[model samples]
Target chain A: MDIKNMQEAELKAAIKKVMQDNFGLSDIADDADFIKDLKIDSITRMELLLKLEDEFGVRVEDNDAQNMLSVDATAQLLKKIAG
Target chain B: MASKIVVTGLGWSTPFGCDLDQAFDALFNGKTATFRTQNINLDGLYCQVSAQIPRNEAIFPFEKWQKELPGNKASMFTIFGLEAAERALLDAKLIDQEGGYVDQNLKIGVVVGSGIGGLEDHFNTSQVILEKGANRVSAFYVPAALINLLPGHIAIRHKIKGPNQSQVAACSTGAIAIADGARMIVEGRCDIMVVGAGEASIGRLGIAGFCALRALASGYNDNPQQASRPFDKKRSGFVMGEGAGILILESEESAKRRGAKIYCEYLGAGLSNDAYHMTSPCADGAGAIAAISDALYWSKKTPNQVQYINAHATSTGLGDAAEMSAIKFIFGDCIEKNSFAVSSIKGAIGHMLGAAGSVEAVATILSLHKQKLLPTINLEEPDEFAYHNDKLINLVPNNGIEASLDCVMSTSFGFGGHNVALVFGRY
Candidate 1:
């Protein structure tokens, strides 16, 4: 739950696990866009954001949810939130 | 001459396990899969017993299925349909080693049916709207809840590009789907059709809705296993059940060319309406008789040819008696003399509603393939109303009976007097 202390690699690994474990996407890339590459529709995006928030114990602003569409972007956002 | 349509494969994700042999064996043994559920507060609802798919626990774990379709926000009925479709296609060898299409140009079609689409999801979304803000509602709610999306998701997943449709006729939905799909092959509309029905409406709303109608068994809450006693003198009402049944139907020519393993021939379907009442069937069984007669007529077979019947007796008093009367009218005094065997699988699996017809159709086909009649369990004393001439119609009570069956009929009548009967013959 203390995602603020998670390293960049750990954050990325967690994100990858969420994609594979939660969404059942095994072929996701480090920079794969949720919408474009993974076919995550609008509803799924909301679900993914909620899941990320739950996993990281971080509050994702509505505006930031739109920007955090890729794993890399999500990791960056997590780092920003932690800072 | 009407083209012959044969079933090449069948799949079901039932409260009973999916293994055909095992499921049939359990049904033969009169094993009850229903149990008391805490999913819905029994204090608020009358019926406490339901045949629910065991989820994320011992027995049949749903976690593996969850992994297969991760983040699947679709309704559970759609998920069940997709899973059954996958199994059926695999059984038919329609998929290649790489899990791709065996023949991309096979002109396959899909017809799936459901009684109430996403009632659970609809209830949840409404709760979210009431408890949380309106903005908290998810976008997938509508797509997951819509009925037609059952086939739409299937076609998209399996790349089936021929005729696509979904049916809704309450409990008769499954049989109508199978009939309509078989017609597609007979009419040269498609060479192969994936047909069946899935239902997952055992949630609060689903149970409460039926409870309000006083259509569910309420007295056997303590003994859940005995809740669904179809065709029995003590039978009170039907027990709610949920699952899916999908069959791979192919033109006889196509099946022969592919060397497909044929299970049984889907001769034809007969459809009729009672025009009597919204919920109750015609007391004289006219609609049921006409439907069965029509099915026999469409199949060009005589009543004497039907060696077995998988009845749609939902354990309700009048419903069982009416169906028995219809069969007597069709088969005459021979029925009471055990000329042919008859049974209802509801005693084991309960009433599957929209999926009942297709599920029982699968049971009928399996009976044909295995040459064994499934027992109508819990029929301790066959209802007097189902008896004719001081004899109970060969209801195949208590234990399964082995018999050679050349042709069998499965009947399904829904809430709106929707009567459907389908005849299947040995391939």
Candidate 2:
């Protein structure tokens, strides 16, 4: 929950909201994995990344991209960058 | 001896999205890109909802969509094919704006197919003539939508000077292109082949034409989202889809020399015709069985080895059952009758017509990569008309199984009983 930590829960909530609003992914629970559990697939994940880049103001590299697979991971990264 | 054909790159444009990676990504995630469009601004015609590819005027120059002026739907396929080819080549490490991948000695080919072609555009042009006048009909109708030109334009633009061709087998158009391209590579005609299918037939004329033939789901119009339910009891005809799917096919030697990224292996292809009726398959599944048998034969593998099969189950009354019976006959009682990793993307994407087969091919590749398989979305109530053999355990929807599936085969049959199958195996 620390503002300095990038992988915070709030950033994850914001991303899940974006996915739900744009791509209609309502079934994605917090514990859901991006590729298997949340089922965001690869393309939408890219789309989601594009949205995140705009929202959180971060330029995620391909190496960093795959690591931000889960909402929690993305949140943690986002908070670290934004803070 | 036939040479080995490997897939180095694949590019697809769908109602889901225009980019190749984007479509492949979405297919794995189980997403539906369907939506309603009432484009009253452009002449006020009631445009029925469709999985429409948003025309990026920059990529698809409006002028290019037309030979002379005012583009039509047929040009949509041609335009999309060109863009996809570029992307595929880029993916294949062949040629890109970055200019690094093409091997000078590599003989390249292009195969783009369409199920319905520019029927809606051609049909709309006819309507415009009746409503307004003959002169109002742009002089560009014939040049735009003819099915043959889908590949012609792509070849002309990219200067793809090798075995230039196209396929048209109704919904199986796109898959046939891949199969055909694989054949070209195996036969040593080309080192690299660009293959995919495209369609832009979602206009009123296209849907109305299918409606006239009673081949579309009319009852589910109220709920468009649920309209394309495949393999369920409440199932009706397929929902018409329009778009293109392209793949970069190359020989393994050529790909390795160039250091290209390979997605998977195109093991083999099978193609056949029902020779029965225009649109209907042999009700007993004879034609489908023949096509599948040929595919397996070409693949040089027994049915038991293929862990998963992406079926051409369009959720049609006779087509789905025919395919099931065919699968039963080929796989025998033990496998076909059991609950396997059998499924269809049409249930989610509707009938993509020509684009159906190629995108589904992508799904199969992803299946091999991730080791997961999704069930047919609307397959809740199991109807065993053609699957009379107890060996067939119908896979239910919403539940995908994760397994170490190695070889997966995909089937696509078009109207006029044109049948094609592509076999894929793990690398």
Evaluated on the second chain alone, the candidates' TM-scores are 0.96, 0.87
Question: What stretches of model 1 exceed 4 Å from their correct place?
Answer: A1-21, A25-32, A35-43, A50-65, A75-83, B56-61, B96-102
For each candidate in turn, the interface RMSD (Å) is: 2.6, 17.1
lDDT of 1 at B2: 32
Q: Model 1 TM-score?
A: 0.91
Candidate 2 residue runs with Cα over 4 Å from true position = A1-83, B19-21, B35-50, B54-74, B98-104, B135-137, B333-339, B385-396
| TM, every model | 0.91, 0.74
Against the true structure, whose TM-score is highest?
1
Q: Chain B in candidate 1 has what TM-score?
A: 0.96
Q: Could you give candidate 2's per-residue lDDT for residues B203-288 as a string of tens digits? A: 76666667677787656645666666666778877776666678888898887888888778888888888999998989888888
Fnat for each predicted structure, in order: 0.62, 0.00
